[model samples]
Target: MVIDSLLVLGGLALLVLGGELLLRGAVGLARLLGLSPLLIGLTVVAFATSMPELVVTVAAGLEGRPIIGVGNVIGSNIANILLIVGAAAMIQVMHPPRGLAKRDGAVMTAATLAMIVLAFAGTLFWPHGLVFLLLLGAYLVGSYVVERRSGTTEPAGEAAEALEAAPQTWLPAVGLVLGGSVGLVIGSELLIEGAVSIAKSVGVSDAVIGLTLVAFGTSLPELATAVVAALRRHADVAIGNIIGSNIFNVLGILGVLALVTPFEFTSELLVFDIWVMLAATALLMAILASGRAIGRGTALAFLAIYGIFIFVQFDTGFATAVQSAVGL
Candidate 1:
């Protein structure tokens, strides 16, 4: 048990370090190519930070543990909003960009709803995966066009900060990206292995393990990014990272995993967790639309809810009682 616990911790550390290296290198490379910081934040940095989720989900799918992949994405999406954003906001009030509140925020809510609809379909097949990937493509293209039309060429506040701290040369930057990718792959493998073992020892289901342990472990990068950005007074970066990461987890990671191997939806997820995720997203959107920063009070509320969420996932007796009550 101790060995497994240590492995999980070690894996999480690697994931955090690896994600930072990957983001720094990728941002530097993008800057060298003259890409706008906003574009890098939306695409490169967002995708880079989400690498841990992508790697873990793909690994789970390949290992015939589809529940782990599905649950990880669902759980990560929830944590991205409640845990990451909440923790960040507590550091400093997070005032997201108005355009993000209107545009990217809507896309995030839509994606969450879409996932819930697909969950009820019983299974995610290749065709469903293709549709999701197509949607992601369209979203990227549409964002590009809109930003261009608006002449919004500035880099994301976070991306600009990252660029300032990145290596100034191509060789070291390329090395960091390559090295980070390798480390992330290795770390995810260790994490999944340790988590599966621990789950078995603890008599928990793969879905439960995925939703709690694996999900939280993989989300560390986003947590670190958001908190750092908030401390730097770059609220847009913190909020934008959460929104972009959530979208990628659903549309990009899950979509690709389904393409490689189809996965069935767990009834508990469809009945409870999916709705919870959607509710969180909706609440976040409302907060953003209010045009006020996510204050410490709201942050505390988010953290409290997330605490209940984690508790519910672990407390099978309570979950069972709730499921029975809901006729799930």
Candidate 2:
């Protein structure tokens, strides 16, 4: 048990380090290829931060535990909004950039609604997965075009700074990208192994493990990035990171996994967790639309909601009782 615990921790550490390195290398390569910073931020950096989730979900799907894959994506999206954004806002009031609140915010809400609609389909197959990928591609292209038309060249603030600081040399950059990709792959395998072992030992569902431990572990990179951005008073960057990540979690990670192996919806996921995710997302959008910063009080409320969510996951009885009382 101790060995598995240690392995999970080690894997989490590797994921964080690997994600940073990957972002650095990818940003350097994008710059070398003359990609605009805005485009790079919307694509490369956003995707890099989500690599851990992508790797874990794909690994879980390949291992035939599709529930874990789906759960990880749903859990990560919830965590991104509730935990990451809430914690960051508590550090400092998060005032999102106007353009992001208008554009990316709308896209995130639409993507989230799309997920809810897709979930009702009961199972996600290759055709559905292809649709997700196509939507994602269209979103990227549309965002790029919009930014170009509006002449918004600046990227998400601190995130762009971090990428701009990466090594400019092509060889070392390529090495970092390759090394990071390898590290992410190995770390994901170890993480999934440890999680499955621990789940079996504790007699818990794989979805529970994915929803809590696996989800939190894979989200470390975003947490770190958001906290750092918040401290720097770049709240837009922090908020942008969470929103962009949530979008990618659903569209990119799940889409890729579904392409490789179809995932059937678990009843608990459909009944409770997916709605919770949508609610959390809705809360974020409401806050953003209010044209006010996410203050300490609101942050505390978000944290409390997340704490209740985690508790419900572990105590199925509590979840069931609540659902019954609510007539769900």
Candidate 3:
């Protein structure tokens, strides 16, 4: 157990470091390739940052533990709202664009609903993955065209902000890209192995570990990004980053993963966790619709809810009771 704990921690560290390097290298490569900043931020940066989750979930599915991947994606979506956004809001009130709820939130909600619909049959296949990918592609292309026509400056500015710490030279960038890819592969294998070992030792399902520890560890980068954005008073950035991550978690991570290896969601997730994710999504929409900034009080409430959710995931009896209540 102790050894497994160390493996988990070490794996998490590598994932973060690896993800950072990957982002830098990929961004540098994109910039050098003459890609626009908006294109880099929307495509390369978004895909790079999500690599950690992408690797973990896909590997899990391939290894016959599809539940872990499903839990990771679903848990990540919940945490993106309740944990990452909440923590960021604590640093400063997040004032999203007035139209964000209607536009971006609608897109996110549509993605969420799509996930639910795809999973409703109690299984996800390559066809489902195809649908997700198509939607993601359309979103990306449409967003790029709209932003380009509207002359949206935020993505370019955000790209510049992202580029500030990245390597400027091609050699270092290429090296980092290769190294980051290796790290992510090794780190994901270690994480899955450790998480499975710990789950067995504790008599918990892999789903439990995936939903809690694995999910949180994989989300570390997002947490850091949100926190930094909040500290810098980039509330929209913090909020937008989280929202974008959530959308990608479904459309991108689960999309490619399912195409490679069909995912079989666990009974645990099919019952309660997915609904919690939907509830969290709806909560964010409600917040956005209300036109109220996410202040400290709201942040505290979110954190509290996050704490409760984590606790419930680990308690079979509590989860059973909740499931029963829902079934009723």
Candidate 4:
């Protein structure tokens, strides 16, 4: 058990390092190819930070533990909203970015709903995955077009200027990409092994571990980005990041998992957890569309809700615990 814990910690560290290197290398390569920094920031960077989740989902699917993949996506979405966005708002009142709710937020909610419909069949196969990929592609292309037409400079302009200063040489960039990929593959393997062992030891379902441990592990990048953005008074950026992440977690990661290995989700997820994810997405949509600042009060509510959600996953006495904690 201790060894498994070590493996999980070690794997998490490597995943973070690997993802950072991959992002830098990809951005450098894009720059070398004459891609604009805005494109790099909006597309490459968003996709890059999500690589950890992608790797884990694919790994879990291929290992015949497909529940973990689905749970990871569901859990990550909940964490993105209740945890990441909440923490960011606690740092600063997050005002909605203009038109984000109408577009990306709408898409995110749609994606969550779409998953519910698809997963109701007990299994989602490659065809379903293909459709999801197509939808994701449409979303990306449409976003790029709309952003271009609007001439949005701030989003393109203020996307971590340091990202532009990547490796100038092809050799180093290639090395980073290769090294990062290797690390991701190895890290994912170790994480899965440890997670499965931990699940057995704890007498919890694989889905539960996936939702909490693996999901949080993959979400580290998003959390760091949101916190840092909050400190810099760029809370909107953090909110937008969470929105994009939730969409990708559903469409991109799950789509890829479907293709790699189609498997049935546990009833716990199809019935309960997915609905929780949908509720979070809907709540986020309403919050963003309100065009008001999300302050510390909202943050505390989100955190409290998330705490309850996590506790319920591990304990049968959730209602009693909540009552005791809230003095109700």
Scored by CA lDDT, what does every candidate get?
A: 0.85, 0.84, 0.86, 0.83
Please write out the lDDT profile of model 2 over residues 1-328, one tens digit for every residue: 9999988988888888788888889889988899878888888887887899998899899999978888898889889898988899899888876666677888888988888888887788999889889988898899889888988897866457757677788997898899899889889888888889998898778888889999999988888877887788776578877887888888888889889998887767877888999899888888888888888899899999999999888896866775576576
Full ranking by lDDT: 3, 1, 2, 4
Stretches of model 3 off by over 4 angstroms after superposition: 153-158, 319-328
**Each candidate's TM vs. the true structure?**
0.94, 0.95, 0.95, 0.93
Task: Please give the lDDT score for candidate 3.
Answer: 0.86
TM-score of candidate 4 relative to the true fold: 0.93
Writing each residue's lDDT as its tens digit, candidate 1 over 1-328 gives 8989888888888888888889899988988888877687667876787888898899889999989988898889889899988898888887777767788999999898898888887788999899999999888878878887988777666666677877778998999899889888888888888999999998777988888899999998778777877778775577877887888889999899989998988777777788888899999999889887788899999999999999988897977876797686
Best by TM-score: 3
lDDT of 1 at 316: 73
Clashing pairs in 2: none
**Model 1: colliding residue pairs:** 37-155, 38-155, 38-156
